[model samples]
Target chain A: MTLLAKNITLSYHQYEIINNLDLEINPNEITAIIGPNGCGKSTLLRGLTGLLMPAEGEVTLDGKPLQQWSKKTLAKQIAILPQNPSAPEGLTVKQLVEHGRFAHQGLFSKPTLEDAEVVDWAMQQTSVIDYQARLFNTLSGGERQRAWIALALAQKAKILFLDEPTTFLDIGHQLEVMELLKELNQLHNIGIVMVLHDINQAGNYANRLIAMKQGSIVADGKALEIITSELMKTLFNANTKIINYQHNGHQKSYCIPVGI
Target chain B: MKTRTILRGPKTNKRFYISVFALAITLVLSLFFSQIIGAAKVNITDFYDFFMAPNESAAQKIIGNLRMPRAIIGMFVGAHFAIAGLLLQAVLRNPLADPTIFGVSSGASLAVIASIFLISAIMPTTTFLTSADIPIFYVPFIAFFGALLATFLVFWLSWEDGNVNPKRMALGGVILGSIMTSAVMAIIVGFGQAKAELAIIWMAGSLYGRSYNNLIPLLPWSFICVIATLAIIKPLSVLRFDDDIAQSMGLNVKLWRMVAILISVGFAASAVSVVGPVGFVGLIIPHLAKLLIGGQMFKLIIVSALLGALLIVLGDLIGRSILVPLEVPIGAITSLIGVPIFLIILQKSGWKLK
Candidate 1:
């Protein structure tokens, strides 16, 4: 029902990056983690997804220890879309998406009719049905991101984790991907957790905001409560003027930088 | 049957079957022609008569003892080299990765030559021996050990931190293979006339008069390696993706990679121990198979083995009959064909060798 991390610590070699961190991921909520560079945002996401093992404490899913669960069973429950995943040359979008069926089949078995239908459904959900015949490398950034998301959807996992889902995209493409995540979260009740660099986009799109300074979470709540000028000054060392603007019948908070 | 049809695309299965049939026919033709047109002529009737009633006639002796064994050995060696190449290329994700390029075959050659040199060096000191009386047996066993050692050395050199970089692996293999081959050459140079000539012929991969005795001990290991490679294909396909993705999909990438490397090394070592390092079969045949067959891992391997068997059998048959008395070594003939096809492949596929 919920993925929870308790008193977890992460390290690379001798340097501990995430120290004594604890958090709970609520079901079906889009949680966006925002932090400056070297803040261990991605590392925390990796730990929650069971991609990286914590040095201390434990990560538990549905009241069971993450380590005790079999890898295949864990994969069926959680799917991770790594940043800029590359495929072999000449792989079409459909084929790349079809690879997500691997954990389900457990072998290079032939695709069943139900599997094919699910693959098609995944593509339809991501709206990349037109690009199914195109090679993955041939698409533009936005199209490729959708194709990758489609691949994640094909896994049919309840929780979807993405690291920097909009790092290299332009403003238009970034919003396209962001809106797709929100759509998936709303329509299918899939839990979406992502590490985003832009604080404003996270404020606009995410249901809950988790701001990290260095390795520990500095603030965790609704976007308006956590993204205040005081929190920005204390955590990010930035002097900003906080402005509340009405957009599309909703009051939104915006941070306008004044000086360093 | 359901799984196969589902796995194959609409056209790939038909092409696969047709290609396999073509390869089988080519194999039979090479066997027939090799047997019929040797120095002394033998016919299909002679084979039939020999099968029906055992005899000691010249044609029967040539077909049963020499030509038949030669053809069968060609098939075995070809399949070994090609499958080894296919496995290595898939694991390393490099077009140039192969047993010969990785120094496994040259290491075997070096070990075989060193053992001979060591024995011959000992002979002159003892009063009962001379350089002319060099023992020929036990070279294959020594070569097999050397090939295994060389394969691991290549793997060990390429490993950095926790990952194996494909480019570094290929480079390490090439450098090690060259050094071993040079050492083999230096050993050949140190010998006197008769021994040196014999060693040179063996090194060039000529099977002038080999028979069933040489193949008996090596075949089982080769068979086992081929089966092991097939068993690991599913994991291998998963591994062809980037490492993180494979791991996220619940695959133990390192474990599968180790299994694959062991399988490839097993294939290369056993083949080189018997048939002196035949050139280009491992490197070129896999690429050819990939070109003829598309990117299905299972079908690509099968086709590579079949085509490799066909190529070597045909090469050996041509070597036997192309020149009247002066027989071209099968290795030399394969190189000639391999180099041109390799050039065409590079031009057509237009893949960066990197």
Candidate 2:
């Protein structure tokens, strides 16, 4: 359950994007990574999830290097959903979710009863159970995203990583996804880490916010402590006013970008 | 009630069983039809007489030696090419991908053509005596290696950074196919008319004179490749998604991709070596299967294998019988029939690759 990135450097095509970045992921909290475009938010997510090998340090899961862990064994602990994943033609939501149990099933063995139960649970958790038999390509943008999340959930992993889960979603759907993630984190106690484009959504939903600039972590702390007009100016070079409110005995914070 | 209804057992959909039943019936009918309806005056009684009676008549010999082996070869060749095409399209994530797209058919053609020229040049006395003059048994073997070599070249050329892009592989296959086609043309023209007629017939693709010699060599290959295809079915289905997504699911995407490609190469090369590159069954039958049974990998493979065999057996039957003394190549027959049916499927299903 301990996933740590120790001085890792990730690069694409010989150019360094994340250099000597060190961070440890908590196994029971929602962590949002907020950064501008090309600031390496997605690259860091890929690096941590074993999708990309770091050029310089190592990513350790339970104090063992990622390479030492077999792909299936590692997959049993960590699941990732890339932005805008495309399914094969004619694949239904249930079929797509069934793929999440791949690491749990043998090469030639049929899916076990547990695997089917997990698939059904994931679909219901994401509220995509109604669309289980529907073609994935025919779903709307929000429903498609939910189906993808359900697929990841069917992996039954302790930690889930998503790259921009709310991109291209309208306001209502964005809130819908964030609320679902919040419920998943609180109720299931699954560790959630996501690279979010909307700073307000990050501040509103994430338990911890890690702000980045040019592939480096600039600030990492609670949303209330790190999300300020000064931090917004540093992260995005925008003039903004921090707005704080109280709702249901919880403190909420968001910043309005007024000028560049 | 909803949970009870949703938690059904692990059986496949009803449509899949129906498709399997329909394909099985057609496959048997096609096999029987291919046996009886050739250019020779053969009938259903000859089928029983050949099996039941020990004294071989002229018609019995024809059925036992010629028609039986040819039909078997036709069925297997069709099945091999269809499954190969399905794997290629799945791995490439392209609807247009087929065995030829990997430089398999054209490369085998070029090798067979070049080797014939070399043999003819080495012995000028037997230069224009047709393929029968040469040791034709080795043609299938030579064509197989040629397919592997061409596929290797295309795969090597398509490699960039750490991964092979499906788009690049498709484009590389196109370029290599054209190069081999031109090379084949140049060799045929430059080498004069020495064995050119035989080479042209092989290139046009026919099951003529194919017998136990061809079927025996392909049997082991079909057994191994088909089993390998089944073994990798799960990864093949996962591979239809983006590479990164597949990898995140704990698949060694690159390794599995290589295995799938190699299995497909085994199928296409063996079948082409036997039948000399029958084209449309590999290209169109998988699409037909996908349209009929949906794109579930296992069901698609099953339906494609049966439909492919059915198409080729029937096509070969019509090819020989329709022309009487003259023979239309099985490849020509398949394309002529496959295109119209493919068009009809397209219009009816409104199938889209995306």
RMSD of each: 4.7, 2.6
Candidate 2 residue-wise lDDT, B105-129, digit = tens: 8888788777767776776644322
Can you list each candidate's DockQ? Answer: 0.33, 0.59
| Candidate 1 segments exceeding 4 Å error | A13-15, A63-65, A90-92, A106-114, A128-143, A167-173, A228-244, A253-260, B1-8, B36-60, B111-144, B190-194, B318-324, B347-354
Per residue, candidate 1 scores C-alpha lDDT tens digits across B249-343 of 76677788888877877777777766778888888888887666566678878899998888888898888888967778888888899889888
Determine which window of 10 residues in candidate 2 chain A has minimal summed lDDT.
A129-138
Show the colliding residue pairs in model 1.
none
Cα lDDT, model 2, residue B169 = 83
Estimate candidate 1's alpha-carbon lDDT, on a 0 to 1 scale: 0.80
Candidate 2 displacement at residue A78 in angstroms = 0.8
lDDT of 2 at A230: 89
